[model samples]
Target: MSKRLYVGNLNFSTTHETLQTVFGEFGTVITCTMPTDRETGLPRGFAFVDYATSKEAEAAICSLDGKIIDGRPLRVIEHQERAGRDHFGPGGGGGGGRGGRDRF
Candidate 1:
């Protein structure tokens, strides 16, 4: 099964390509995502990397965790799913607005 790993304590200048190149040493990197702030559009100093297999993910965690890159040590670990949350974020769907209530 594919595995996702969370990479934290990253430098602000880290790029998606840089992550792939670094993590690719262990195995195939399925995807790399670096989240940027909505307003400033700057790197959040963290990233998520998905490997083609669990073994590949493990290899990366073992080798890259605490490894220094760009003057900062990396924190690599298996990604955990947040309870009661999805890609769109928390809460159970329908929100905002007056729920069809006539505001007169």
Candidate 2:
């Protein structure tokens, strides 16, 4: 089956095409995407890669996890579903303890 990989610690200047090119050596890149900030439209310092197969994904991770790209160390791993759920009842998703008084 195809695998999705998470790449972190990316340089803000890196683009989806750059990532696709880098990972393309390992295997066919189905798609590569870099998350961006909504307002500033800047790289969020991470991205996701979808490879044609799980073996390809593993190979990509092994070859690139600690490799430097654009002067930053890349963190490549199998992407897992993020653990963020709606934990708050009202104003949701802020930093820090969930039960803390709103001081910000």
Q: How far is candidate 1 from the true structure (C-alpha RMSD, Å)?
A: 6.2
What value of lDDT does candidate 1 attain over all alpha carbons? 0.94
Clash count per candidate: 0, 0
Q: What TM-score does each of the candidates earn?
A: 0.80, 0.81
Q: Which residue pairs in model 1 clash with each other?
A: none
Every candidate's lDDT = 0.94, 0.91
Cα displacement (angstroms), candidate 1, residue 38, comes to 0.4
Best-performing candidate as measured by lDDT = 1
lDDT of 2: 0.91
Candidate 1 per-residue lDDT, tens place, 23-91, comes to 999999989999999999999999999999999999999999999999999999999986864768766
Kindly list the per-residue Cα lDDT of model 2 for residues 1-104, writing each as its tens digit: 89999999998988777898999999999989888899998889999999999999999999999999999999999999966676665567667666556756
